[model samples]
Target: MESDESVSDSTRPVDSGVTRLAYHNGSWINADDVCLSSRDPAVTQAVTAVERVRAYNGRLFELDRHLDRWQRTTKALDLTGLPSRPSLSRLIDEAIARNGAWLARQKEFGVLWFATPGTADSPTLVIDLYPIDSALIERRTRSGSLLVVTSVQQPPSACWSRNIKVRCRLHYYLADREARQTDSDAIGILVDSDGTVTESSIANLLIVEAGGVVCPPSDQILSGVSLQVVRELASEIGITWREQRISRERLAAAEEVLLTGTSCGIWFANSIDRSPLRAAGPVYQRLRSAFEGRVG
Candidate 1:
């Protein structure tokens, strides 16, 4: 056991080494100084929309694409006070520049923006940049991941477009908790109401078959920019990629399953619900290299 003074001293900030910055409304501030109202709808009612992008080796990858998605989300969600696409892009670049130390220390960092459905008087907007820990990335890349299916079905997209990313995520939280009951580092996969595999808790899913890479149709899942980019890369490399509704059965039968996201890039799943899916293989390596080569 550690002494209380030792614990308290440990809690105190020493040479923490990283500098963080935040952007809100139209200006930049220290990340720790930013705040959200407890009564805001985005907080109280979970009506926040978000877009997360990456700065690879000091450059933002696909800035136009992610900002384009944010534009659509703002329109569809009726958000306000958000900056224009050009302004948002500049703001992210500014964040990276202002947090120069953090950027210098990291080969990969994340730039995440949030738009809250604020009151008639005001709307909330925020952008933050932080380093993506190399250890977590290494763990997923080295051995792949363990995923478990859960009873908590993904909210049907028919009710609302699955393209919109929101913070109202209690179902996903619970599903992830259930996955932790199985393994500490495990992640949860959500099936749709119709027994089709839709996506994982935070990232999109793609499973490889004899034909090639098959992902659920965008109608059923978010059309992730990373997913689209990888498919284009596959085509450039002469590997076929298609969008088809993947049933739970099809996923279980897959030779390899991968999760895609901006920060994660491409990661493999070693198993899903005790069913062995191939670990990182030649195809996974090829796509991963293609992605890294483009962004890195």
Candidate 2:
């Protein structure tokens, strides 16, 4: 197996010989120069609605789906004074065009939009492009991920809609920190109050049981864009997919465990809480190949 350290340099984008640009409010600025005021509500309270889109061959992938989620989140939060959907769409296009040189240096990249309630009447919007962590992706895909079931529980449905993507993720931060104490590379998986596995810090959890794909119901977890793609891919290939409560015991006995998210796409987990499970099971290989083909 190739070491992540050895693969790191190869996966990184070469110097593009151009400054990257970011969209800030109504202007484009040097990516490094964009910042929010210290007193802004987004900074002080972490009240930001966020959406991320991946670029393949310098083109945004699943853009409409991401934008739909972004709009829904802003509306659910009652955030006022946001740009119209069409205007926001054009801004995202401008952002990508402005950073094309940097994006062309890599096979894929991530573009993120952050919306927040500012200190004044209008809301705040910031858009930036980021490189994917190829080394980490390479490592996880090769050896699978290690997960530790964290003590932190997913916030109840009454607190907010499960589908809203927001920046109030202190719980995830704490969960990852707790997991690191067990294994530096281990990711923390959150469970519901009833001990049903909900999700990981930044990824959605899915398990293959009896040759079928099963994930926690949408009401119990975030409705992930990548997970939705997986669902479509599964159906296209005639693989049965469904949703249900995944207990700790069920997870341990799963035929295979998979993690899905924006940055990482779909990868399997070799162990949870240090117990070994199947790695790169047949279903994972099929879905991963389908996903890669779809992306290309």
User: What are the TM-scores, per candidate, against the unseen true structure?
Assistant: 0.89, 0.91
Which candidate achieves the best TM-score against the true structure?
A: 2
lDDT of 1 by residue, 1-296 (tens): 01112111011222346746688777677676777888889878888888877666667778788877888778888886677788777787787778787566655567777888665577888888655656777777768888888777888766667887777677777777888798876788777888877777657899889848998888888878888788888898877888887887787788788888775678889888877545687778888889878876
Instruction: List ranges where model 2 is wrong by over 4 Å.
Output: 1-17
Q: Over the stretch 1-296, how does candidate 2's per-residue lDDT look in tens digits? A: 01112112123333468777888778888776777778887889878899878776666788888888988899888887888889988988888878767776766677778888877778878887777777777778778988888888988889888789988887777778888898888888888989999997668999998899998998998888999999999999988998899998998888899988876678989998888554689999999999899888
Query: Which regions in candidate 1 have their CA more than 4 angstroms from the true location?
Result: 1-19
CA error at residue 115 for candidate 2, angstroms:
0.9
